[model samples]
Target: MKLVLAIAPDRFRDEELFVPQKAFADAGVETVIASTKTGTCEGMLGGAAEATTTFVEVAPEAYDGIVIAGGIGSQDFLWGNNDLIRLVQTFAKDGKVVAAICLSPVVLARAGVLKGKSATVFNSPASVSEIRRGGATLTDRDVVVDGKVVTANGPFASKAFAASVLSVLSPISP
Candidate 1:
């Protein structure tokens, strides 16, 4: 079975985490939820998720890929997180699937993995500027896949983003 790491901020968008995680489960892929700290992390819409580990505790080599869920808290907590950025870089360097939804795509951009790659993120001036600064060619689409990097625009694209991540992970079961 394939293994994926799902990272979310304390106030992540509910659907962005739950939707893709359910899709990964249904596909027989194992997912481990991680955050800045371990414990119960609340979602933007009153949902709660227990983070099994912290970003610093994860060993990138143990998983096939990673999924970053985005929301308002992401800007405060994840956008400039050096640990998460290093993890994203490790995943990309290893050629593993690196995926993000909504505002979290900026995390990948900051990691320098999206340079010259076509990607999309929640349409905001800050997000657009950061991705461009990282050398990404932004596109007007719900989900954009550039090699192993998958980026989605917002919570609405969670399911499709999950499917795209699945497609990129090797040896996935139907």
Candidate 2:
């Protein structure tokens, strides 16, 4: 399966990007890194990754899932990006797996995809208020999955967040 992983140009939480990426890779999922521009993006903790594509280049239909990595930069760069918001909305409408960790859930909130859904994000006033205002029932859980939408609180929940995403994309039969 293929997935698009979106991050900011800089300061994306290192674990939020790397942990889920490793989980996806271990599950045989192909990930395409996307950002506002094509180049290397530095994580808050000094990790670096190269963005292979720009937001304008992402085609929702080309992948089975979308994951947005969050950090302080996400609040700065991704919150008001119309293209990224539209892309997240498209993924939700398509019934594709959509996951966001840390502060990135605000993008989903801004996309109108979180309406009436249950989700969680890092405990910040802006993040909480925006999510609730978007119509999601904000939860304090480490991870919450409402149908195809998966959300995690912060970096500490990255692994569980990824596992939830994998379960959505590739469910294990009883």
Top candidate (TM-score): 2
Give the range of the ten consecutive residues with the poorest summed lDDT in model 1. Answer: 1-10
- Candidate 2 least-lDDT 10 residues: 165-174
Q: How well is each residue in 81-110 modelled by candidate 1, as lDDT tens digits?
A: 999999999989988899999999999999
| TM-score of structure candidate 1 | 0.95
Model 2 ranges with Cα > 4 A deviation: 170-174
List of clashing residue pairs for candidate 1: none
Give lDDT per model, in order.
0.88, 0.92
For model 2, residues 16-135, the per-residue Cα lDDT tens digits are: 999999999999999999999999999999999999999899988788978999999999989998989988989888888889999999999999999999999999999999999899
TM-scores of the candidates in the order shown: 0.95, 0.96
